[model samples]
Target: MRIAVIGGGISGLVAAYRLRQRLGADADIVVLEQGGRVGGVLHTRELAGEPVDLGAEAFVGRRPEVIELMSELGLDDQLVRPAGKRPLIWAQGSAHPLPGRTLMGIPSDAESLRGLVDDATFDQVATEPQRPLHWEPGADIDVQTLVGDRFGSQVVERSVDPLLGGVYAGISASIGICAALPTLATALDNGASSLTEAVRTAMPAPSSAPVFGGLRDGYGALIAALTAASGARFVTTMAATRVARAPGGWVVDPIGAVDAVVIATPAPVTARLLHHVAPVAARAAAGIELSSSALVAMALPRETPLPDNSGILIATGEPLRAKAFTLSSRKWPHLAEREVALVRASFGRLGDDKPLFWTDEDLIAAAVADLSTVTGIPIAPIEVVVQRWPGGLPQYAPGHVERIAALESAIADLDGIAVAGAYLHGVGVPACVASGTAAARRVATACIENTQR
Candidate 1:
């Protein structure tokens, strides 16, 4: 059986690797990457004589898939936890420490949010339990609406927006509550008396393990390891333009016939590839919205007085142009040991194309200005690196899960075909890994059954 995995991102790599494991020497698995290299957004670069992640920096340690995958690859000892985890919110012309005991900015204790929100807002939040929530079970709703209705607009803007914005590059008013924050979604769906109480009840006990984990070297190592272990033929700079139904299986354009195919590219790319064979899935994939972002990484001199915390998240409506800032040197212990300080500032998001229109120099200037404004530090950086990701984040709008389900149903009858990526499940590394592995298994099983028959 032969399987073709399109788009050599982490998902595609994982799919190809899992396919080789499942089918052993019998399967002809190949990975086609249009780019010059693999790893997709999981990119790492050298700065200040040390490795710094220009793309995804870390993965949630609580997710088992990533940990299990690392263990399988003999990378268990290479995992490095953050030295500091407290992140501050920059708002109202100052930086405020994010409250502890909160779930996605939803504070479990109203008193903990005293400095974050106004007294009136706190009073409203305290009285929220008395008011009955009215939400249909399993129904989708915008995150801003649900949180704002219960906790007031101040909480949504001051607290929730910054956190969600950092993750989705989207406004909470448009992002689906359930799709973005499933834990809070469940509580809301169950008609919880108070969001605070619900969050407190649902909060997991604190663990010594850091919430996030990263490789000692970089995620690039993981990608390279997967590529080496997969033992699949890799075709670089080859884009799959189309896929058509052949007599026995599918024919990927320019790649000849394959017994099975996994479309693991971005939603729009996947849509175009499937347009000729699966129109319903194509339409659904095309409908998914995406947001673009840019990161300005700077290597400052060691004398720069960086913040003690992990990073700072900029609340919406703030005067600063940058959305957030990560003190890479402080957040990651390995980076701190270097002679220079590494910092990353994020720019642009959904509905904000101003940064996208700016030249690289202008973007860097803006990021530096914002960093100085937020941190009250005006030191010049020894080096600057700018990375732009067009359509970097997929926005999970209301009814997104249902739309994905419908898309899946539309293609269920089609043989030897499966789709997977951040668009189908959670956007984190672990979730994408799981999606890729699952897609590989589905296509592998189908191809094996056909061969047996």
Candidate 2:
């Protein structure tokens, strides 16, 4: 049986790899990637004689899938914990350390947010527990609306917006609380009187292990390892334009017939391919919005004294153009062994227009200026690497989870066909891995059933 996996990003690669493991030598598998290379947003580049991630830098260590994948790839020993984790929030023309006990900027204790919010806002938050929770169970609401209603707009702007922006690259006012922060959402659904208490109760206990994990080499290593192990034929620079139902199973346009198929590309591309076969699912996929952003990596002199924190997140209304910054050398001690300091600055988000419109040089200049302003240091980098991701992050609007479920149901009727990627579930690396693996399992099950019949 021939199986086709479209889109060669980590999700697609994982789907293809898992499929090979399940079917073994009996199946004919082909991976179709439109780009010349794999890895998608997991690109890594060499700078100052060290491998630095230009795309996603790390994955949440608490998620077992990524760690398990690393171990399977024999990258267990290469897993390195971050040297620093705490990041500051740049606001009110000053840098304030983020509170320790908070989930996605939602404080578990009002006193923990003393310096971060104004006195009026603090008073409002202090009284939130006594205000009597009023929320519809299982109903989706924008993050800002919920958090703002309970704690006022100040907390949402100074605290929640920055943290959510770092992840979704979208505005908190539009992002669904349930989709973005499920723990908090569950607590709200359960009628938790205080969001702070709810988040605190839901948060896991602090562990000795680092919150995030990255490969000593780079995430690119994972892509390479998966490709080598998948044992699937790769067809790079070949985009699958369509997926139509065939007599026995399915046909991937320009890629010939396949008994099974996994559409692992972005939602828009997935929608286009599945349009004729599953119009309802295609419509749901197309409705999901995407956000764009750019990252500027700079190599500064080793002697430069960067901030002690891991990095600084720019709160909304700050005088800086960049939304976030990562002190790569400081966060990962291994990078500091080199003769240069590595730093990455991120620009743009859902409602922002500059990053999409700015030239590479403009982005670099803007990043440098913002970094200097925040750190109070005169910045001059020896080298700069700019990476732009257009529509990189999918916006999880209200009812996103439900919409995905409906899409899944719509496509479930088709035999040996499944969709997977960051768009289907959570957007993190681990979530994508799970989504891809699950899709592979579904296709494998269908293939087995077809043969039996």
lDDT by residue (1-453, candidate 2, tens digit) is: 899999899888999999989998878989999988888888988876677898888899888999999899888887888886688999899999887678888877789898988999999988887877777789898888888888988888888899888888887886897788887778777877677667876777888777898888998889899999898899998899889999999989898889999999999999999899999999999989888899999999999989977889988888789999999888887777889999999998987756868888899899989999999999999988888888888899999989898899999888899998887789899999999999999999999989898
For candidate 1, the per-residue lDDT at 112 reads 73
RMSD of each: 1.5, 1.3
| Local accuracy of candidate 1 as per-residue lDDT tens digits, 1-453 | 789999898899999999999999877898988888898888888876677788899999988888899899988887988886688988789888887777778778678788888889899888887877666779888878877888888888778888888777887886896777777778766777677666876677889766888998889879888999899999999999889999999899889999899999999998999887889999999989998888989999988997898999998888889999999888988778889998999988889957877898998899889989888989598988888888888899998988898889888999899998989988899999999999998998998899899
- Candidate 1 — which residues are off by over 4 angstroms? none
Per-candidate local distance difference test: 0.86, 0.88
The model with the greatest TM-score is: 2
Our model 2 lands, by Cα RMSD against the true structure, at: 1.3
Each prediction's TM-score against the native? 0.96, 0.97
